[model samples]
Target chain A: MTDSWLTSLITATPQEGFELAITLSRRGVKYTQPDPEVLHRLRPDYANSADSLTAASHVIAVNFQTVAAANNYWRT
Target chain B: MTDSWLTSLITATPQEGFELAITLSRRGVKYTQPDPEVLHRLRPDYANSADSLTAASHVIAVNFQTVAAANNYWRT
Candidate 1:
């Protein structure tokens, strides 16, 4: 948590930026939880549930919108 | 995949913006890998790897940088 991990988000392409977005989302969960045991234990509750998956998607869309805005919607 | 889930990234606060960033990351995964079974099957491989988890953080940092820049580093 103390280590410096980020370098830049000015990706060469939208595809890379999109992949980075996924990583950001997963990392966010890790940072918020920080405990693997708890995360694993709770996996079952959401892994098999469609609702949970959809909710996860919703969260991603929100973040994507933010990223899109940052990159000016990847205007070229 | 075509539900049009995003509304806006102009969050009321940075905390909300950060949360949105996480959501965007997760959603990106879903979009990239629509098959839940595949995602579930591959989960165990990285779930326990510290390197994978750290990498996730790096990704988050990258996306976060994008978000930070978008928000002007959340400057007042």
Candidate 2:
């Protein structure tokens, strides 16, 4: 398999993120909690919403081999 | 504290992400591995960049208490 990947974000309550992490990991899908620093650097909207974002919920950054695959995983 | 928050994404190599996770966690920052399904659902660009993004590196989603805090963490 290639060593490249794409990234996406999912904002959810800490409770939901915790549950999803378990679900995705069991399915052999890869993901990570975004580094607030890194997120601030990459996404402007994230930077703008920092306080609200951190105070209430968490952000999850997911990886995938293809857009279709990522879409399928999320939608399904 | 209120229970609402925003979200964002950061794409990087797996190596860098691992290291940053260590650094942030040690500093008392909370984070987690993202669920790819969740990401695909949230960010459309991520879906669009799937091929190139997955073929190159990983994505990181970070959280913070404020925009300035997130910026300070990432920039420093």
Q: Note the DockQ of each predicted structure.
A: 0.08, 0.03
Clash-forming residue pairs, model 1: A59-B23, A60-B23, A60-B24
Candidate 2: tens digits of C-alpha lDDT, residues B1-76: 1333312222144444345443322121133223445333444543356553342222223322221122333452
Model 2 C-alpha lDDT versus the unseen true structure: 0.31
Native-to-model Cα distance after best TM-score fit, residue B60 in candidate 1, in Å: 23
Q: Give candidate 1's TM-score.
A: 0.49
CA shift at B13, candidate 2, in angstroms?
Answer: 27
| Residues A1-76 of candidate 2: C-alpha lDDT, one tens digit per residue | 2444323424243323333443343234223444657544644443223232232222232211122132232321
Give residue B21's error in model 1 in angstroms. Answer: 17
Per-prediction share of native contacts kept? 0.10, 0.01
Error of 2 at A34 (Å): 29
In every candidate, how many clashes are there?
3, 24
Question: What lDDT is reached at residue A74 by model 2?
Answer: 32
Docking outcome class, model 2: incorrect
lDDT of 2 at B36: 45
Question: Which regions of candidate 1 are displaced past 4 Å?
Answer: B1-76
